[model samples]
Target chain A: MLLRLAWRNIWRNKRRSLIVIGSVIVGVIATILMDALQNGMIHQMLFNQINLNVSNVQVHKKGFKDKKDINNFISKPAKVETIIKNQPHVKFYSKRVITFGLLSSTDNSSGVYIYGINPSQEKSVSIISKSIVKGKYLDASDGREIVLSKALAKKLNVTIGDKVVGMANTPSGSIGSDVFRVVGIFKTASSEFDKTTVFIPIVSAQQMLNIPGKIHEFAIITDKYENADIVSKALQKKLGKKYEALSYNEILPLLVLQMDLYKQLLIIVNLIIALALIFGIINAMLMAVYERIREIGVLMAVGMKNSKIFSMILIEALIIGVLGTIFGIIFGYGINALLLSGGIDLRWFAESLSSFGVGAIIYPKISLENFIQIITIIPLVSVVGAMYPALKAIRLEPVSAIRYV
Target chain B: MEIIKCENLQKIYQDNGVPVHALKGINLTINKGEFTVIAGPSGSGKTTLLNLLGALDKPTEGTVYFNGEVLYKKKRRELSRLRLENFGFVFQAYNLIPVLTALENIEFSMMLLGIPEKERREKAITLMEELGIAELANKRPNEMSGGQQQRVAVVRAIVNDPDVVFADEPTANLDSKTGDNLLNLMQEMNEKKQITFIFSSHDKQVMERAKRLLILKDGLLEKDN
Candidate 1:
């Protein structure tokens, strides 16, 4: 009976009830879409870093990543390869010799981190082979061929078939120099990374630096990137404390921090929307209560308890909230589905977004957790909003209230 | 047998910081099965007396007893329960809930008492039939006429078989013919069910039908017959 009364009471002023309901619907949709957009952007950023450069995990000699000195090269490459092959999750691994060198063309010179890689093995670990924008990737037989980013090519005022010289410090404290042909130029999502990186055949680099049979880093790709941390832990334990196995999260701490900050921003935005909903609902319900002052008095005088009166008002508010939320979730998910398929095209801001390693198009994604959060929050907010009005209804003196117009 | 007893009933009101005494030093008792009327001019404390007697308000000074038990001494929750079980009220404006049908309004008090739905519906329909407003059962209060709405209010008041039925200016909004019919119905119910009926009114038609009359003037009891 109380439910019936409450349901009917809400319709007493249909326009007012709908206004409150409409505001609630808008709030739900805003929160859901905002959260989905933030998640989609962050997810793209993380995957781009992993696929383009970091692979899933990396193995480096102790102190090598900090200093990048020629003397800190991995001496026993065969032992590291044996342990990596034993890991079940390892799908592909590429060995590379890394050095900071100055590359000079006839017209310009720029400092770059040069990676000496086996062309076929590097393709299995990273997407650099597919990212070639100009000229062909380097071949295993081509000793003097080099592949550099478009940003680096532009800085050096060089193109394919241009002659360049690479110079770096050798392990013997002597300057090692080699002449190379620019074979390819590639572009990646991160412009900052593209501006300072180049690749050459491993044998050519080792011969130039006088470090035969030595490599600086092992880039490993797991079957799934999510399993990188588990595989890295296992490899670290087997390889002992001399070597460091680092996951993508460990290699790129800034990207992980960016994701966390976006999540906090999502929370703050939703809280602001929730507070607005609470106030809107309160104002609507308070008006409903005051308009029926005489009816409430009659209810009290006819032996309806104060508690029942309070419950009736609260139930009415909850009905409005639940009804609005139902429609909001339906529409929110519908919009999310449409955006997920077609994606939000942000190519207009590609220059700004690519600076941070995020892709141009984002596909909005929502989890079951998002659904649960919206379902619980709106109805709870409705109850809180109605509390003051319900209390006011029950506090009126019956005799004076009955006499009120 | 006495159903209600009151001693030195005094009610005062504060109108913007001025004390206006509405009822002063009135002693009264009403017996069961009596068709009684408390009559007075405007500002003569009839409504004030009814509110106090109905336990709807607290008197500034006085004690009201119902069936030899002190009415004001109980807690507010206890008073509400007592009213639900033993008292019925008919207001002047026919204060039926606008959203409910006539039958729903009639069964409201029983619904509050946790009565079964089927039982309350049957009781409400039977009472509406006796009052000749059974056809208005499915109609909301706004769909009914003034007299029909009043009949629904009366049926609602007495639906629980309350020990006392208090009517405050029940006929003020009705025409002469409708007011007489309402009075006749109340007299018939009073005699047939042996239910105590107390009314506060200045209508001559109401006073003529009453078996006992008490008149008030200037907040004092002027006469009793």
Candidate 2:
């Protein structure tokens, strides 16, 4: 009977109930949208970083991470490659030689990092060939051919079929210089990579730098990203102290750290929104108690105990919470779909984000877990918010309450 | 048998730093199955004494015994429980819960007593019929006339079958004819059900229906007959 009374009481003032429900809906929608956007952007970033830059895992000389000089290379590449090929989880691997060199073409001269790879093997790891904007990509059989980023090619006044001079330090402490024909111009979405990297054939780089039968780094691809750490540990044990295995997280710690920070920030934002909605609900309930003062007095006077009065008020709050949460979830999903379809445009702030190698358009993606959290949090906010007003009604004296207008 | 006894009861109100004695050493007793009226003008300690007797307020001094148990010695929660089981009340303004229908308002007291729904509904319906407001059972307090609302309030008070019914100006909001009818209803219920009916009122109709009258003047009992 008390439950029936409480349920009926909520609809007695339709306007007040709507105000509270509206606030909850707004709060839930905002939280869902923000959470989805953050999750989507971070997922996109991690995907790009792993596939384009650091293939799930990479193997380097034991001390190469601390100092990537001309001396750090796998001396016995044939044996290490054979071992990696035989591993069960290892799906693909690419041998690459990375070094800093100066590029010069007539009037232009700039420092650039060169990545030398077997073209066929590199293709299995990254989509660099598909990113070629101008000219033809270098093939494994092509001799003395290289690919330059469009930005770097433009700065050096070099094009396809044009010869450029590259200079780097050799293991013998002597300067190695060579002439290379630009066969392709690649365009990475990130400005940093587009302006600074030059790709060349691994054998040609090995011969020119006088490091025959050696490779500096071997990027590995696995069946699943979550198994990267497991495969890396297995590789470390198999290769012994000669090689060090690094996962994507270890290679790009800043990105991983930023993702963690984003999660915390999103939680705080959601809490603030929830708190604001709860305050609005509390305000509405308090006013409701005041408006029904005489009614409450009458219930007490007719032999209804103070505890029953308290429970009835609490039940009213519970009903409000359940109704508000149902509408909130619906509203949240609707807003999420709208935002997801119409991607957010941040072209004006592209330059600012470009500094961190992130894109302008942010796409929001929500998971089941996040949706469940939103649903759970709203009801808790309503129930907790209703407590103060219910207690206030319970504390009211029957005489005074009956006298109130 | 004495259902209510008060000994030298006192109640004081602080009015802007001055002590105003609302009840001053008043003594009274009410017998079971009697229609008793505590009659006085406004601010003559009738309501104050009624509140103390109903266990709604703590007396400034002395004690009240209801059915041989001292009420003032019980905890607030215990007192509330005792009041729920032992007393029903009707106020001057016809305090019917605006959110509930007339039938629901009467059934609320039985619900607090944890009575089963089917039984409570039958009792409420029977009481509403007895009070001649059975047709208005579905109407909210605001939807009914002042007299109809007051009668609903009366049914709500006695629906729990409490040992005592405390009514503070039960007919104050009704017309003279309605007020007279309401008093007669209380007297009839007292006679038929053997349920004690106690009221604090200045209304002549309420005073005339009383089998026992306790008159108060200047915060003290002046006459008892």
Candidate 3:
């Protein structure tokens, strides 16, 4: 009977009830779309950084990360490479002889982070080969090939096949300079990375830096980033000593921090929207209570309990929330489907996005967990919204209420 | 035997920080199955006494004895249950739930008493059939006439077999013929069902049909006979 009364009461003013229901639908859909877009943005950013700039995992000497001293290069490169090759989870691995150096082209010299990579293995591990704009990637056995980013090539007034002099401190504490011809030019989303970094053949870098057979890092790509942590931990345990294996997130904490920050902001935004919705519901219900004052008085005079009145109003809130959530899920998924297929183009902000190494286009994604979580929150918002109105309703004085003119 | 008795009943209404005395030092007793009327002019405390007797309000300084139990001392929830179990009320307006059908309204109080749906529906239909308004069972209030609505209200008041039925200006909105018909129906219910009928009204037809009349003037009882 209470349910019936509540159900009928909401329909007493269809427009008013529909307004609340509509607001809930709009709020939930907005929440879902925002969550999906932010998640997609974070997902794309992580994907680009891991696949192009940081590999899923990297193996370094124990003290190498903190100091980055040339002397901290891997101790047993050959043995670790063999163990890594046997691991099925490892999709590709490349040894890098990394060093901070300066590159000069006849007139200009700029400080650059240099990576000496095995061309063939690196082709499979990084996006550099595919990102090439001019000339060809390095030969497998080449000893003197180099690739310069478009930004760096421009900064040094050099282009493809131009001669550039690389200078760095040797392992023996002496300065060494070598001239190499750029064989290719590549561009990445981040102009800063392009302007500040270069790559050379592993043999050429080993000889120039005076670090023979000792690579500073072994960057590895896994079948999936999801499996990277387990593989990294397993390899860390297997290697046992002298080497520390780190997943991409652990190696690049800044990217992970940004992702977490986006998630937190999304939650706060959702909470604010929900709070407003709850208040909206409360206001609507209070109006319903006020309009039906005489009816409520009649009900009370006939023998309805205060708890029954409170529960009926609360049930009305639940009904509104449930109805709104259903519509919200439908529209949220509908918009997500359309957006997922074509993606939301932020190409207008391409330049700004490129500066941070993030893609301008985002494909909104909705996870089942997040969808269920939002669905569950709607009713709770409704209940919270209904609280004040329900209390007001049960507190009516039947004696005067029945005589209300 | 006394079914209801009130001693030194006093009611004060605080209107805008000024005390408006709606009832002052009135005492009364009502026996079972009596067709009683509390007759008064406007602002003469007729409705105030009805509200107190129906367990709808607590007197400022008085106790009401209902079936030898203290009505004013019971908690609000206890009062609600007592009202549901023993009393029914009909206000001046046809206070039918706008959303409900005639039969649904009739079965409302009984349904709240935990009566099963089938039993309540059967009883509602039987009562409507007896009142000759069975055809109006599925029609909401908007579809019913004033007289038909009042008839449904009367049926609802006694459908639960309440010990007492309280009506406050129940026929005020009806025409003279409908008012007489409604009074005739209430008199029948009192005689046949052995239910006490108490009314707060200034209607001549109601006063004429009353077996006992308690008249009030200026918030004070002038006569009870």
Best by lDDT: 1
Lowest lDDT 10-mer window, candidate 3 chain A? A365-374
The iRMS of the candidates, in order, is 0.8, 1.8, 0.8
Tens digit of per-residue lDDT, candidate 1, span A184-205: 9999888887888888999999
Candidate 1 docking quality: incorrect, acceptable, medium or high: medium
Model 2 Cα lDDT, one tens digit per residue, A3-50: 888888888999888878777777777787878888877876776667
Per-residue C-alpha lDDT of model 3 across residues A333-401, encoded as one tens digit per residue? 888886564788898998888887766787777755567667788888898899999899888899777
DockQ score of each predicted structure, in the order shown: 0.69, 0.52, 0.80
Top-TM-score structure, candidate number? 3
Candidate number of the best DockQ: 3
1 versus 3: better lDDT goes to: 1
Clashing pairs in 1: none
TM-score, one value per model: 0.90, 0.89, 0.93
Error of 2 at B126 (Å): 5.3
Q: Rate the local accuracy (lDDT) of all candidates.
A: 0.89, 0.83, 0.88
User: Model 2 captures what fraction of native contacts?
Assistant: 0.51
Model 3, residue A290: what's the lDDT?
88
